[model samples]
Every structure is written in structure tokens, then in C-alpha cells.
Target: MINSIIKLAFGIEYDGTHYCGWQRQREANSVQEELERAIAKVANHVIDVVCAGRTDAGVHAIGQVIHFETKSERKDISWIRGVNSYLPADIVVRWVKVMPNAFHARFSAVSRSYRYIIYNHPYHRPAIFSSGMTYYDDFLDIDKMQRSAKCLLGENDFTSFRSSQCQSKSPKRYMMDLTVTRHGLYVIIDIQANSFVHRMVRNIVGSLIEVGCGHQPENWIGNILLRKDRQLAAGTAYAQGLYLMLVRYPLHYEVPQSSIEDFFLIPLLS
Candidate 1:
């Protein structure tokens, strides 16, 4: 097959609060649309990009991967500055580069890391604003949260945390690790897995929070996993506080960046 496609991969970051999600949509604001507009201005032509993952509305990403095809052969093109200048303050192109045509941004990825943030407080919420902040009075016991998250390793069916909108054909996946830590009033839960259902991470976080709050037994986490039913899981957390932290690809196909900034550096609550 003869192809004239120039595959350009980019690292992106966005607040996601002001947009619908990563996918393109009609009438609704989306990160995809905003990104395409900025990139078009930079490349001086039409370009459509596909992301490794499509986060929900109000979600955020510090380091997300996307790929697009263009015929322009200018490797020296100034897309970084040009695209950022046109993009709204909430979204940005951190880095961009040419990639092998065989690399699929989503499918080529090996794993993804995600995080959930909780404002645990007794009398107030948690102080987490760059401006005047409310709901700033809670505490999360990190040690307890960590202890409660230990049941989530190895391969298993994650039906308890799956979302109704999830399109995956199966609920089986591997969880590499899970960590619960606290920085001030922020309760951060980090989890890495081969893949995740739409609300799996959030639902797991909710259950962990419940365990920390003494609502459920420590062993209840295992029971939920064994239940294998979405309805039996804890409530899915809000999208506003979740983040698509990282996407790992083979080292050979990795994009070379001076400073490879990604979602791992992002604060859980931000």
C-alpha cells in the first residue's frame, strides 16, 4: 500500500475542565478540536490526531500521547510555540516530533498510569486552589489508605470497578502496582495497569476512601474484587479530580525529548 502519511507524535497537557474530552464531538467543546485547530495553524494544513486514551470531561492530563498524519516533511517546523500560542490557556503542546509510521499512539502503548485525588477532611473539604479556596478542612490517613490498597496486584477481573460506558470486550487486566500517599490534605492514589475500564480507577479509589474512613472492613476490598459485578462496586469518583498520568511505549519507538515531562509529575489533586 502506497502511503504519503507523515506520522507526527506529540506530548500534550491540559486542564480538561473547560472541554468535553479527548475525542472529537459535535457542538460540545473537546480537547481534540482545540488541539487540531492549533496544529492546523502550525502546519498550515488540516491534521487529525488520535490519543492513546480519551479522558472524560473535567479530567486532566499532564503527559498524554497523540499521533497524527501529515504530508509536510518539515522536521524543523515550529509547531510547539505556534500551536501553544493559538491554543487556549488550559491546553498546550509540550513537545512534537516525527515518528515511525508503524507506531499507533493508542495500540502501541504498553501500559497506562492513572491517579485519583481526594480531599479528606473532618470539618472542611481540602484546600486545593491557586486562588481563594473553599472546602479546605479535611485529612486523609495515607498509611491506612496504603494498607487498604494492597489487594490490587497481579491479574484479575475488575468488573467491580468497570463503568457502564466502558467499551472493552473483557474485564480482565493486570495491575502492576497501587500506592496511596498523602501530601497535606491531598489523598493521592496511584495505580498502573495494562489497561483500565472507563471508571475502574475512580471506583477503586472510592472503595479505598471508604476503607480509610472506616466505612468498610480492610478485607472488603478483596470481596469486591471477587464479586466481579460493576453494581457492587463503590461509587465512581468525579472526573474533575482524575488524571491520565502516563503512557509507556517501547524504548525503540519512544519520542526523544530534552525534558520528557509527563503525567507522573502532576499532583494528584491538581
Candidate 2:
């Protein structure tokens, strides 16, 4: 007889510095492997999870969403606490909910958001070392970065900003929003899009830095988009500064809103 299957969705937060990203890798440690191992101990069987986005190595996430099918007979809280008890200190399962069989972690997502944090300061702070914040000594002009960001606010071909190893079928994506702001010595770049090509956010931020530093004109971003040549854009930014902030879904899923707001670089807490 086929076991009764249940689909569960979980919100996870992790520091990606210690692992080789969210996807399972054969050669090195990965966040996926650790999560799967913990989940399997609770399920008493193999458990496979599909994430909303496969974040790259050293890229962190505060609102990562994932789903898995299981036949385990356990309470919802058991899945949360039991899994957490087995997981490493750097990774935690924030929330858990039963999802409809039709729901999916990746395909059901309507949009995904990311935040890039740059510590634009002359001296490095030991407190924030290797904590997913990129350090840059140059002063960044927030006004210029904001002006250049407007050119990417709608659906467009992002070939120039995509990674050479991108596996997406098309280069077109709809950018819902892009904002550049400063918090003390940090430069925060928050972006939301229907989807993204591999390393798209980092690539755009790298070029924006050039504009903010006055090395490139404010309109240079638009020109790069028009050219559709990856070679013409700025180099990809460091992965440590990137955080998969949120993944939006339709209301039917009822995913919880317990996002880790403290981790974001924007809006200093009052």
C-alpha cells in the first residue's frame, strides 16, 4: 500500500558562510545536506526538500522557503523543534505549516527579494567580520545609485547582468522594485523581482557601485541593458553581502510572516 503523503512547507534562516550554499553538493559541505539530515532523523526516512531559490555559496538567507513530502507521523511542533534540535547552530527552522498538495516551494513563488549590504567604511569592524556584509573602503554616493536603479524597475532583458553559467531559459525578468539607501556606514540595496537570472542582483550592484563612485555615468546601467553583453557590465559583487530576504506567494498558501527583520541592513531600529 502507498503511504499517505503529506506536503510540509518550512521557513528557514541560515548563515551561509559555513556551508557551500543551499543546494546539496557532493564535494563539500552544504546547507541542504545538514537540513536534510536533520529532517530525515525526524521523518525516520529520507526527506528531500525543494527551495524557492538555490542560493549560491556564501550567500545568506533570512526568509528561505522550502517544501518536502513525507510520510512521517509527527506533530507540527515535533517537526519544528525536533528538526531544530538536530540542526547546526547556524541554521534554524523558523516556521512550519502544512501546504496543499498542489503547492510548491519554487514554482508557486510569485516573487523573490534580496538585500545586499556593503559596509562602506574606512576601518573594518571586528564585530561584523565575515557576517555576510561586504566591506568597501570607497564612499558610495547613494543619490547616484538610486538614480541608476530606476532604469531597472520594470520587465527587461537582463543578459548583461546574468552569470555566464546561468541555466535559465530566457534572459527576461520583471523587476518589481529596487531601492538604494544608507544606514550609518552601510549601503543597503533591496531588490524584488518576479525571478532572477543567476547572480543578477550581485552583477547589478557591482555596476551600481561604479556609478555611485562616479566611475560610470548614472545612465550607464541603461546603456549596459541595451547592449545585452555580459562582458560590458561590472564584475559580479561578492556573495557574502547578498541575502535572500523573502519569497512572495499567493494568499492561498498562508505562509507565515516571521521574517528575520533584524538581519536586514535597511531601516535602523528605533
Candidate 3:
């Protein structure tokens, strides 16, 4: 008799401060590597996980989603509790569910969102919210940043904003939304897209910061898109400030929904 196959989906959040990235790397410690080891302890067998996005080193995530298949039959809560028992304190399994055979953590997702948090205060650096935040000492014009970001809202070839090491075949990606807002001493940049190129978020943020800080004109953003040259854009921003805020799948998948607003508004006070 053949054994039945069980596919599972999990929601996880991680503080990526000390992690090399989401993908397992041979030379460095990785979140995926650590999570897999924890799962192996519970399953008593090897298991591979597929995540919605492969965040870069030092990047964080609040609503990362992953899927894996296992032979062992385990309760939903058991997967959470069991996995948590073995994982480091920085990683947490928020939810677990049995996914339909067709569900895929990466492919089934409709869109992904990221938030880049910037500490704009020139004199004082924040004690908390430091792990995934970028600090800028220059005075930034919020109004110019908002208008400049509007130029990136529609589908376009993002070659200028993609990394040279990117493996995607095409630089084209659809931009669902891009918003720049300020809350007290923090400037939050929220972006959603069908997908992204490697370091695309950081690259875009870097250019936007140039505009925000008066290094470039508001219209310069559109001009950079036209150039299609990576060298013409600003340097990629630090990975510390970027967060994989959420990944959205079709409602049919029955996965939980997440809000960008609530997640971004958490108090930074330690």
C-alpha cells in the first residue's frame, strides 16, 4: 500500500538581523537552514520548504509564508508548537494549516508587499526598531518623495532598479502600489507588486531617497526608468531597512490575510 502525502502551509515571522537571508547558503547561517533543522527534529526526516519570497541578508519579514510536504500526520497546532520548540527565539511560526495539493507557497501567491522603514531624525538614532531600519541624517522632502514615487505605480521594466546579480529572465514587473508616508520621526515606504527583482526594493528606495533629499529632481525618477541602466540609478539602500511585510494569495487558498497598516504601526519604543 502507498502512503498518503500531506502538504502543509505555514505563516512565519522572523527577525532577520543575524540571518544571512531566507535561502540556505553554504557559507553563512540562514533562516531557511535553521527552520529546516527545527522541522527535521520534529518530523524525524528531512523536509524542504518553499517560501513566498527569498529575502536578502539582514532583511526581516512579518508575514512570510512557506509550504512543505511531509509523510507524518501531525495536528495543526503541533506543527506550530513543535517547530517553535526547536527554533531560535528570533523565528516564530505564527500559523499552520493543511494546504490543498495544488497550493504552492511561491507560485500561488498573487502579489507581495514590502515596507522600508527609515529613521529620518538627524540628531538621534532610534534605540528600538533598529534591526530592520535604515537611518538617514539628511533632511528629506516628503512631498517630493511622494510625487516621485507615483511615477512607478504602473507596469514597467525595472532594469534600472534591479541588481546585477538578479537571475530573473525579464526586468519587467507590475507595480500594484507605492506609497511614501511619514509618522513622526519615521518615514515609511510601502510597495506592492506582482513580483520583484533581486534588491529591487532597496534600489528603488535608494533612488527615492535621492529625490527626497534634494539630490535629484522629482522628475528624475521617471528619467531613470527610461534609461534602463542600473548605473544611472542611486546605489541600493542597506538591507537592514527592508521588510517582507506580506504576501497575498487568492482567497480560494484560504490563507490568512494581513494588513500593511497595522504591521507598520507597531510602536518602536523598546
Q: Give lDDT tens digits, candidate 1, residues 1-270.
A: 454868889888888877888888999999999999988887778988899888887788866899998866554347787788999999988778788989988998888887666655667653454211112233555677687677788898888888888899999989998988766656667888888877788789877777777777788788899988877767876777677777888899966433222334344334
* TM-score of every candidate: 0.88, 0.95, 0.96
Query: Candidate 3 — which residues are off by over 4 angstroms?
Result: 264-270
Q: Mind sharing the TM-score for model 1? A: 0.88
Candidate 3 clashing pairs, residues 3+ apart or interchain: none
> If the candidates were sorted by their lDDT against the true structure, best first, what order would they fall in?
3, 2, 1
RMSD of each: 3.5, 1.7, 1.7
Top TM-score hit: 3
For each candidate in the order shown, give its overall lDDT on alpha carbons.
Answer: 0.76, 0.90, 0.91
Candidate 1 colliding pairs: 120-138, 120-139, 121-138, 121-139, 124-137, 125-135, 126-135
Candidate with better lDDT, 1 vs 3? 3
lDDT of 2 by residue, 22-54 (tens): 889899899999999999999999989999999
Q: Best lDDT goes to which candidate?
A: 3
Candidate order (TM-score) = 3, 2, 1
